[model samples]
Target chain A: MSLADLTIAEAGKQLRSGQATSVDLLEAVIERASFTEAQLHCYLTIDHEGARKAAESADRELAAGTDRGPLHGIPLALKDNFCTRGMTTTCSSQILAGYVPPYDATVVSRLRSGGAVIVGKTNLDEFAMGSSTENSAFGPTRNPWDPERVPGGSSGGSAAAVAVGSALGGFGSDTGGSIRQPASLCGVVGFKPTYGLVSRYGLVAFASSLDQIGPLARNVGDALTLFEAVAGHDPLDSTSYPGPVPEMRSDLEAGPKGIRVGVVTELSGEGYEPAVSTAMAEMLNRLAADGAELVEVSLPTFELALSCYYLIAPAEASANLARFDGVRYGLRVDGETVEEMMARTRAEGFGPEVIRRILLGTYSLSAGYYDAFYGQANRLRTKLIREIAEVHERVDVLVSPTSPTVAFELGAKTQDPLAMYLSDVCTIPADLAGTPAISVPVGLDHQGLPIGLQVMAPALGEAVMFRMARAVEERAGFTARPAMAGLPT
Target chain B: MPIEIDIAHVARLARLALTPDELDRYRSQLAVILDHAARVQAVDTTGLAPTAHPLGLSNVFRPDEVRPPLDVDEVLSQAPSARDGYFEVPPALEGA
Candidate 1:
């Protein structure tokens, strides 16, 4: 088998057995990237020389008995939003024209320490504001399943890179459904850990309260390994969870024999495409057949999750993004005065969708509208969190389709912003309540596009979440690879 | 009450100088979004505290200790325009 086909665990075994070197894994992914990148556009930058040097060092170290565990010498991609020292970190927006950080984000530091090879930075929606990566200033990342369809965003590029086999896994930040939605559409596994479980120090802030970084991988185990590498407390991030990171590797192989899988009643029927619903039903049946007890549970306030998210996230974004004026780093447009320069720079730097969201945030937080808009949304968030917690008291985890439909054609919903936002319905509840959730490929729809089943767990409930996800992964037997992967296997 | 979205005013508050066409386009689009968002207004969340974050945790503080800061030259090098170790900008006091 080609080196690119190996999962992280399998690759680690190869490295340990002296059968394959780190350079061999890096070379395979680099070669795969050369063939697929032109068609996929998954990376903003691919550091050919830097990655080679890192892989060589990892190989040398391993020879000297300095193995850094599973991630050592493993090739991976990062979402552009994460700051990397001396590397361009644009968040895929023009506003950050040619800006490179002098310091690495805490997570980037973790990955580098873990001995992972950084292949390149992946693309996302400008400031991660849009569901479709079409909002990226550079351009949209095409779905590897079909070049015509969007690879779901704002982490589309990372998901597409993993789906196309150019990278074994890629790390992307999940705010709302950014990581999970794209993973679903691209036929891969995406996990969004419980908020605060991962530090946010170097992730470009977009709605600070909601953003959490996680991994997109070819399978559930690889995703968990990637998550384990970066999940921990950091003094740099004030919100980083102080509790010990829950141990999950031991429980991954366990079956969900008596796990109460909550089938979210509100997430069922209506709005979902018939094909998607059919795939979801089949996945549920497979889980039931595998010994998981499925129970019907309702989160009534889930209907308001989208609206609440729109208000709360953008309000925080307007405040967080205000730092990108003309005076600081990034794009600058001179004017007669500093105030004029700041206004003109922002107008030119931010895109239409970004500008719209910023304005919405401003209007919502403006005097007289605060109580009616931002205040009301924040309260709704509290209610949503409470409902999710209450339901989890009975069920170990919640199950739903990752997205309402499979990958849709690019430009399908870009015109109507609301239509684009509606795509994240199934994934938003977990984000609102700050719980752990994952999207695992279950089966494919009639169009042959992959369908994802999302499993959500209460805060810090990694053990149960991984158990159910592994159960789904084993039961689904979803072996259909994207024809566009086009790898020489 | 349906909001009369003043796109221009909101843009000014947001420090974005939108063109007239963008202003017109966003006015209608944002109205539709806000109209949908009005659902939250109908429900009275009496006494429910706003969730600043889902973890029910407040802000954290680092130890108040003196430490070396980033290099001044390196920080200044990234500014749009800097002069003699100071960031250069247009007139800040407007008329002055």
Candidate 2:
């Protein structure tokens, strides 16, 4: 098999045994990325020389027996939002087109310390505000499954890179299903840890309360590995929880024996595409056959998740994004006065969806509307969390379809913003409640698009979530490679 | 709509200059969003307090100990316009 096709685990094994070198793997990945770049548009920037040097050093260290754990010498991609010292971290927006970070995000530092070779920075929705990568300032990332379909976003580029074997695995941040939704659409594994479990020190904030950094990989094990490498408390992030990071890998082999899986009644049926519902039903049956006790659980307020998320996230985004006023960094537009300069800079810099969200956020948080919009949304958020907590009391994990539908054609939902927002219906509640959730490819729809089965667990319940994901992944036996796998280099 | 002017007001608050076309588009879009978000009102939160954060964390202060800060050059290097060690911007006043 080609070195580019190996999972992080497989690549790490080869590198450790001296059967292959990091340089060889890095070259293969870079070459594959180059060949796919024209069609897939996965990366915002690929650091060829830096990656090569890092891989060479990794090989030298391995030769000297200075191993850096499972990630040592493994090639990967980072979603462009993370601050990588001296590397352009655009978040796929024109405002920061030429901006490079001065410091590495805590996750980037951790990944580097683990000796992972970051080959490139992947694309995303501009400031991670949109559902499809079509909103990206650069361009949309095409799904490897079909060139015409979108690889979901704002982490579309990261998920597409992993799906197409451009990278062994990649890192993407999830605010409202950015990682999981794209991973689902791209037919890969994506994990979104509980909000405070991962540090947000350098992740360009979309929604501070909802944003989290997670992993996307070809398999559950590889996703878990990437998650372990980056998940932990960072003193730099004040919101980071002080709890000890759980040993998730150790529990991978544990089956769903006697595990109670709560199948959320509200998440299934109606609104979901017929094929998606069928795939979900089959996956749930497989879980039941594997000794998992399936019980119908209800979170009545689930319908309010999307509305609550749209309000809270945009409000937080408006506040967080106010820093890019053209005074300190990024694009600047000349005006007669400072206020005019700020206005023109923002008008010229931000995209329409970003502007829409900022306007919505500002309106929601404005004086008279605060009690009606922002305050009401927060209260609904509390109710949703409470309802989810009550459900968890009876179940170990909640199961649902990762997305209401599989990957859609490009421009399918872009014209209608609310329709685009609905794509995240099943995935948003977990973010609202600060729970760990994962999307695993279960099967393909009738149209040959991949379907993702979502597994969610309460805060710090990654172990249970992983166990359930592994069970479903094993039973689904989904091994269909993207059609792009056959593309000639 | 009752809050059509709020779109322009919000844009100003956000320091974004929207064209007339954008203003019209956002005015309608924000109205729809607000209409949809109005569903939260049906929940009747009553005495329930709002949740600013799901994890319930508060007052996450770090030590006051001093640590190395970013280099001035590196920090200023990202600015579109910079002079000496400071970021350059338009004048604060029209003719100061």
Candidate 3:
């Protein structure tokens, strides 16, 4: 009934049919953000002036007989790591507290060109280094389901904004499940496309090999729409897929009938919470009822992913983040010499988690330990890839709980790094393999928090992945909204 | 068991200046994380080439034609200190 409740496709139809104006949609977004921002902390900044101007221009364009597709005039958010010409792009880190990019990232430019109204930028963990948003230099973004709990990270703000209706849909960079884990915790749809499927030209690098820009939206169909607008090769990013992006169709009413789904044996019931496991078991039963052929598939390499990721990601981060020295841009501290000033600036600018990662990375790449840590992780990565590829030969798509548990309290696992890392155990395997995966809200936990089912497909297999995700979305019939939406402002 | 290593030495190599208090905290934290990640060594990677990248792309080359570059003035303006459209930093090869 509410303006924010309408999916992007529905809202686009209304805009084209003269039922709702772009201004009306913009107002709905602002009102929702104002009501919930204090409790949810979903955004790092809200560009009211820019968004209002963009909405007005979109209205003018449509009235003048030019249409820009589903996102035309619809309010959408981008996670802060993406460069947005003049908008401040802080990766929830103090090092670049007020830094603004001089040029737009490839994705940002594409969305702008598509006539989407840019609402604002969302927060992320400091350089996307943590599983919990608690690692952000700014305070953690709270879950919309319950304000005391984390929304998940490093794309937590994007997930929270979408869940709470602060934005219709948003784009987030997923490196090690930054997008999906948050989407799972916040009860929304998040898709991490296969590696090389999207350009990362202006995304602040975390792990260059693993980072990907994708969509977080209300449901599977909406996620596919957003992904289509941004996916494809970009000449600016040499790592982008050199071939034409595969055609993706949006007619996704297909059920999981006759599809062979692999239930990852390593991730099923053992480490997941009872509430989460119950929902997962129920999800499998529903899939089976919908004519999906469910079979147990083992990906033993799953156990090595978490460990391998920590080393490989941090090691790459140490190098990618070295560009933030005091010389070129961002925070600078005074010292007697260049190196001292650089060191002091970094020491003062970076948060504890960032420092911990840099040290770990440096130590791994150090002369005495290169063969022991970073090198070993790379070799193991190859082995992991091969083993995962072997399993994918049998199943059309693999399924698992997106996260091991529901949204936990803000400080629940922050003190213990290992405990915090375990939250991402289910999601990291797909990231390591550079394959496509999506998280769909399957059902709710006993505490009434949302649970997500992850659908994974082989490299460049997004068509099948989206089909299965849509099937799960339809069968689960998860229509419950977070109680935060009903609370008084 | 936590393995032995010097946190201070690693910090210095990374060009990070950490206080004694921070070093003590990191020493314990890094030890635990490293010990956990050590499991990577147990993975049987025999006969497999190291995977530095998932896509396995090498030396991606673009056309030699010149393209528009970022504005120097705009980039320098965002730096902490700039002089005559150049980023200003302390003299290198001196200080720690």
Candidate 4:
């Protein structure tokens, strides 16, 4: 069995039938994680001993006839941003390097409850601020398909882990396309649910309103399974929704026969590489062939999304991260006095990109500039929300390129921060609108790298996104493992 | 539509004591960044209220309830130095 072909759902089936023991399955996953870690630099830490103990317990549970449903005995990875009690949830930053949380993030608790064994915590950009994992203190995570290129980030490590079969599925947090961009570059399916669908209680705050925890997996089915496990209201996070959670897997069975799929006109051309454009167009053709109506919808304000995002996200981050001052927790820097200590601590703890964000955010939210910058950005955000709402009335799902192109070589655009930020252009609109979007592997480019097709559903419509994404995955049907393919031993 | 990106000012704000070479490099980069940012000014947003959230969920209030914190000593053990019940650090002010 090419374990790569087995989604988490299929893996669960095998585990339930006594076809594979959790320890045996986890050993395979751990080995893959280690192998990929060495080449792709995907992990900041690997917890084999803990994972083995968890796996052993899972076996005990199965022996006791107490299965935790589809996720029982499944191996999963978590982005470093999600706090896993007793594990260093560093967010790949020196600021929180030695910090280990005393309690699990709501998502971590949910995943554990569902019987998923966490193999390790993956690397990411510091504080989930940058589009490239290059900002990570540990080091950049390489794209699994080509070691020379980046895995789209800040969820790069999570995406790379899933892409290389290091884990059956994993969790990632998205702020301005962090999850979807990496998923696209790594050629896996990544979903970012509606903002409030998944509790953000333990997710290390980035842009508070923008950050959301979601799933990255081999296929849409696995994505749905993982999503269902981690999503729902949490008493700890008031932003979490108490509304209806869709039966995503069943919705997939109902399929895309009459769904209205819109091709977002603004996301189509200018910055997109030919391969990305071709991949998206091909998916549109496939959806049309499956009897789904495809229409061209306009998001006129989308051109301003990146601008508004930069201002608003940073403005909020500046406030949220203020609690990290030396007094509270995490890293502390000593100085002659408390004021100096605070200054020294912040100066020494944060990376250049993080400091840049805090300053920019502080400036934007400053009293005199508030109306000119933050206030104006919020207004533009409202218009964006209204436009997206109107468009959804005409379409069941929206289609776009997840990224402008395949992963670029390391250091290629790092020096040009502006160019680097543009990599997220295609994926940012959905984040601004608080919609659910997923990136599914569509095809490969000439050099044999994977491309992704982004499918977006309106607020709380993750099921529709999954149905459409699965349709594209089914039709395009491209399955090439990362260059360093991890076939079972 | 030209905005001067002063590297010295930026360096001071970031608390980085930049060398001459570092200042020049950052100056060139910031110039390009601001030029790109100027695109926002050209946008006609006369009547639009700036958006703070795309999802429209506002007034997200959690129940005010006290929860157990991590072991204080264990959490504080992570600090570089500590004394008594407070974190021990260099004093707040220094006569420079």
Cα lDDT tens digits, model 4, A31-97, are 6765667778778888878888889999999989999988888888899999888888888887788
lDDT (Cα, tens digit) per residue for candidate 3, span A134-174:
88887888999988889999899999999988899999988
Off by over 4 Å in 3: A485-489
Between candidates 2 and 3, name the one with more favorable DockQ: 2
How close to the true structure is residue A129 of candidate 3, measured as C-alpha lDDT?
81
Clash counts per candidate, in order, are 0, 0, 0, 16
The TM-score of candidate 2's chain A against the true chain A comes to: 0.99
Interface RMSD of 4: 3.1
Error of 1 at A279 (Å): 1.7
- What's the true lDDT of residue A183 in model 1? 96
lDDT of 1 at A324: 94
Q: Put down candidate 2 lDDT per residue, B45-85, tens digits, no spaces.
A: 98778887688988888888999999999999888889978
List A-chain TM-scores for all predictions: 0.98, 0.99, 0.98, 0.97
Each model's DockQ score: 0.81, 0.81, 0.80, 0.44
User: Candidate 3's chain A scores what TM-score?
Assistant: 0.98
The residue pairs found clashing in candidate 3 are: none
Across residues B1-96, which tens digit of lDDT does each residue of candidate 3 receive? 667879899889888999999998998998898888978887777788888668687788777789899998888878999888778888887532
Model 1, residue A405: C-alpha shift (Å)? 0.2
List pairs with backbone clashes in candidate 1: none
- Angstrom error at residue B37, model 4: 2.9
Q: CA lDDT of A33 in candidate 1?
A: 81
